[model samples]
Target: MCRLSGTKSKKEMIRVVRTPEGEVVIDDTGRKAGRGVYLCRRLSCLEKAYKEHRLERSLKTDVAAEIYEKLRHALL
Candidate 1:
């Protein structure tokens, strides 16, 4: 589910993962080895997650803006 919008449906959401090594990346395959968070597959949800620092809180680490940009590109 999207942390911000509360949207459900795995197929309609994107998974972002924070690896044990502390690297944050989008998990396109959904089988990555790490703690993961889900967000609605929309720019608004992405922006909300970034702006509110929800991703950082959920992953228990800092999330760089560049990673969000990369996610945007992948979603597009």
Candidate 2:
């Protein structure tokens, strides 16, 4: 489900995760061991999540700027 839009979408979504060792990463395989949050693939969803700190709130950790950078690149 998208944390921002609150939708269970069939469209591809970005999976951001905070690992057990406190590392935040994009879980391309969707099997990473950690707390994870989903966002819609649209740039709008990413931007809203970034600006509103929604991802950080959901993951319970500080998300890095580079993570958003990577997500933006992926969305493109």
Candidate 3:
């Protein structure tokens, strides 16, 4: 018989959330009505998102400190 890995072990899954104002929120579920982008829960992915400003670029707006915190917490 063959066995398959569990969903919990899938470290490459990414979730996408839509924002209230047509923006995307990456990683956190703060109950805010905004688009969200969920990358693999990894430091490297988080760093890449921040460094590349993908979140801001995608949201088409500036990212605030609190938002960054929320993302970090979710990613961590």
Candidate 4:
């Protein structure tokens, strides 16, 4: 489900993952071996998540700026 919007449709979402090694990354495959949280495929959700540290809260890891940049590109 989308963390910000509470949307259940994953067809329009992005998978952000916290790997076993504690790395936070965008899971393009959606099958990465780790914990993950979904966010709506909208710039607004991305912005809010970035500013509010929602992904970090959910994944229990620190999300880097580059990952947000990658997510921003993926949304477009």
Backbone atom clashes (below 3 Å) for every candidate: 0, 0, 11, 0
Estimate every model's Cα lDDT from 0 to 1: 0.84, 0.86, 0.57, 0.82
For residue 71, give model 2's deviation from the true position in Å. 0.1
Tell how far residue 50 is off in model 2, in angstroms: 0.6
**Worst window of 10 by summed lDDT in candidate 2:** 1-10
Candidate 1, residue 69: how far the Cα is off, in Å: 0.3
Model 2: per-residue Cα lDDT over 25-49, one tens digit each: 9999888999998888889888888
Which of the numbered candidates is closest to the native, going by highest lDDT?
2
Itemize residue pairs with steric clashes in candidate 1: none
- lDDT for each residue of candidate 4 in 1-76, tens digit (9 for 90 to 100): 3444643666567898888999888887788999988888879888988888898889888888899899899888
Q: How many backbone clashes does candidate 4 have?
A: 0
Give the per-residue lDDT of model 3 (tens digit) for 27-48: 3333456654445566677677
Sort order, lDDT high to low: 2, 1, 4, 3
* Residue 13 alpha-carbon offset, candidate 2, angstroms: 0.8
Question: What TM-score against the true fold does each predicted structure earn?
Answer: 0.84, 0.87, 0.53, 0.85
Number of the candidate with higher lDDT, 1 or 4 = 1
Regions of candidate 1 where Cα sits further than 4 Å from its true position:
1-7
Could you report the Cα RMSD, in angstroms, for every candidate shown? 2.2, 2.3, 7.4, 2.1
